[model samples]
Target: MTEHVLYGGKGGVGKTTMAAATGLASAKRGERTLVVSTDPAHSLSDSFELALDGEPSAVRENLFAVEIDPESRADRYQSIVSAIASDLRAVGISLSEDEVERLFGSGIPAGGDEAAALDVLAEYVDSGDWGRIVFDTAPTGHTLRLLELPDVLDAALETTDSVRGQLHRMATSTRSMLMGPAAYFGREGGEDELAELKARMERAREVLRDPERTAFRAVLIPERMAIAETERLVERLHEVEMPVETLVVNKVLEDVDEGCSRCRTRRDQHRKRLAEIHETFPAFEIVTVPDETGEVHGVESLERIAERLEL
Candidate 1:
């Protein structure tokens, strides 16, 4: 059974770095690990110091990385819809040219990137090709939308299937009088495809809600706004039944010089926020990463961060 780990938080909170470190740690432990970035503004490549694509590329002995390109995914999704429309036309259900233009000409739908990312994520989870998979999700709002998409899409698909079924029945009933028996068409192929898609979504939702198979880790800084947003994110995750049990507090000032008053004041503020984090999320296992002196990038820096992760 492959384990899935996801790191999500406010943007610029170091979710990508934390996710990369965890992937490195898992690979170091001899697991075949894949680190996936769902952020449109991908930084996983920067963190790993390696170029990546939609297809998984090897980072080292047991580590792989991929960045989901939302624009490309959205284009692919539009192509799929066009194919479905053609299929409908082949079955004697001709869509008006106006309808086709309206559906395809307007470009990617709102939130299409997130929807496409969810589809790809579900496929990866279902593949079970790696021992461990880690996700560097988008900012809190987008991540929440992605998590909720399975249920929303499932419902929409169900309704669409029902309407299609009704149209099929009506067409079948009227075919004899309108275009004769030669015009009759069964929607078996489309129905089968829809059923399979729904099943895939259900499996994805199950995997996400299973704590043993999936771990949702929320990352945050010590700032008041970040903490508040994190609280809301956790609450929403719980509502969706994908509860987060771990919180990663990144960039803690562990060694502020006593001579610098400004540094001391900032450190004191961090300490106060740290105490509040503990008090607020007492049930969560908190992991703190110290503020590094220089930019954290490349495999070596990720390894150092991994050591502090304690994952």
Candidate 2:
């Protein structure tokens, strides 16, 4: 099975750095790796100091990176909906464009934009080219919302059948267009947009549920607030049946670096936190990243962190 690793946590806790380092680790092991960013704020590029866009851009010898945004996919989705509404309006249909959008948009039972973005990521996964994919995801709240979308969507669909059936039918046709011999989306034939949406949702559900192949790991600082949040995330994942497999403690101070008394005191606090992490989640692996004074960017810097991760 193809392994996928998704790194997430608090906004400023260095999750992207960990994700990128892991990608570097994969590449060093000769794995064809692609690290993509699904964070709307889009910091993967800045983390690696590499240029990125929707299409995957090569970051290192074997790693490629892309920063996907909901706005981009939402725009494409919007245009499709607009054209669809216009066609309906031309036929003297009573439905307005906003109504048409709400009809589909409201039914997007999950995190509206995140589910759409995952659809994009799933396409890349299905390409059967890369050995691994590392996802530098958004912060906890947004990531939770996105990951939980499939279940929300599934429940909503179960509750409302009358409106969902047409879209389901459309999904069948669109997938057939994309995956079938009769596919001609831009030419003599076209796909059912509703069908496309269904296929996308199904893929997200599968990805979110499959723990053996996908790992949702959290990165944290050795602070009380960070540990508490991560612990809560673990419990939330358990409640939702989405498993979190690893916890990483970043920027750990190795020893009391000669600084002000405050720095030494904080270092002592980290020592205690490490012990707490060991006690709290004994089954899970804990990886430490040293506090580096120099900025961590580029493949060289990532490689150093990868070594610490033993990745």
On lDDT, the candidate that comes out on top is 1
| Candidate 2 least-lDDT 10 residues | 182-191
TM-score, candidate number 2: 0.81
Where does candidate 2 clash, by residue pair?
A: 170-195, 171-194, 171-195
List model 1 lDDT by residue over 20-84, tens digit each: 99999999999999999999889999999998999999999899999987666554445435555
TM-score of every candidate relative to the true structure: 0.90, 0.81
lDDT digits (tens) for residues 1-311 of candidate 2: 33788888988889889888998889888899999888888888887897889888888788888888565566535544544454444334558556885775733323655775677667876787888898888888888887877767556544444333444445446657667954324331113554565566677668767887788888998988999999988888777777676788998887664867988888888999999998989988788888877667777788889997653
Best by TM-score: 1
Summing lDDT over every window of 10 consecutive residues in candidate 1, give the lowest-scoring window.
74-83
Error at 136, model 2, angstroms: 0.8
Task: For candidate 2, give the lDDT.
Answer: 0.75
lDDT of 1 at 170: 62
lDDT of 1 at 289: 93
Clashes of each: 0, 3
